[model samples]
Target: MTEQQRKDYFDKVDKNINEFGYHLTNVFESKERPSFFYSTGIYKSFNLPEIFIPSLPHGLCCEIADNYVKAFKDKRVVPRNEKLQHLSGRFPIFLIDVPTSRLTDYVLSSVWYYKDGNYEYVQVIYPDTQGHFPNDAGYDYDQEILGEFRL
Candidate 1:
């Protein structure tokens, strides 16, 4: 993208963040990894850690994320490091702290927009069909397939 195009892209992102509490970005899957979507501006606006979900269908991810932002705006923040059924979805969400080292790989746009990496983040971890989390015994699938949790 040209410099002008890049400027316009960031401008749009800024507008979205200004209008809404956070901005949602969807990254399609590639050969190396599965698809993912994440939020930006949550920390700047609400002082709440940003969130992301991976491997689920893109549309579903967006729906859940939008709902999450909705709840967030409603002053219903998600609790971290525990099983949660607060968001609108069948799968309970577990918020795991996203290490600062991994921030560049996941939330680069957010960091760029804020011009800093001092903010905190939490990955919205989802469980398998049996409701078993990554750390649980008899967990059904690999954690990375959904999303990585680095605490």
Candidate 2:
């Protein structure tokens, strides 16, 4: 993307986020990654719960992530799974809007999770063209890794 296009895209993203009562918490950028990742949080006046998930092994983390994405794509609350509840407790849901021609209102319900106490990443649940969440069909799917950063 050209510099102008990049600016325009982020301008829209910022406007949409503000319209939705959210503000950017942090932005992750890396020379190694192809895309930029924006972390957001609800405004203070919104009175939303803040949820944090402790670091877990890769396999269990992926499982909870799959379920989390499914719940958001289906427009339902995240399921009350024992493991998820134990790890994350209760937290508010955040949204990241993606500009796509296929779906104007496309967005990802997102949260933060730690991986083995060494890495932290954002997990977002979004729908594909088939209207199905990824990793639901027994396919070995990889969640979109927004970026990797050094602390």
lDDT of each: 0.73, 0.33
Off by over 4 Å in 1: 72-78, 145-151
lDDT of 1 by residue, 48-121 (tens): 77777777777777777776666665564656676668664677777777765675776667877878546767
Candidate 1 collision pairs: none
Clashes of each: 0, 1
Q: Give every collision pair in model 2.
A: 51-91
> Residue 73 CA error for candidate 1 (Å)?
4.8
Predicted candidate 2 versus true structure: per-residue lDDT over 51-137, tens digit per residue: 222222334434443344434434433332122332222322222222222111112222221112221223333333353334346
State residue 72's C-alpha deviation in candidate 1, in Å.
4.4
Model 2 TM-score?
A: 0.26
List all candidate RMSDs to the true structure. 2.9, 14.1
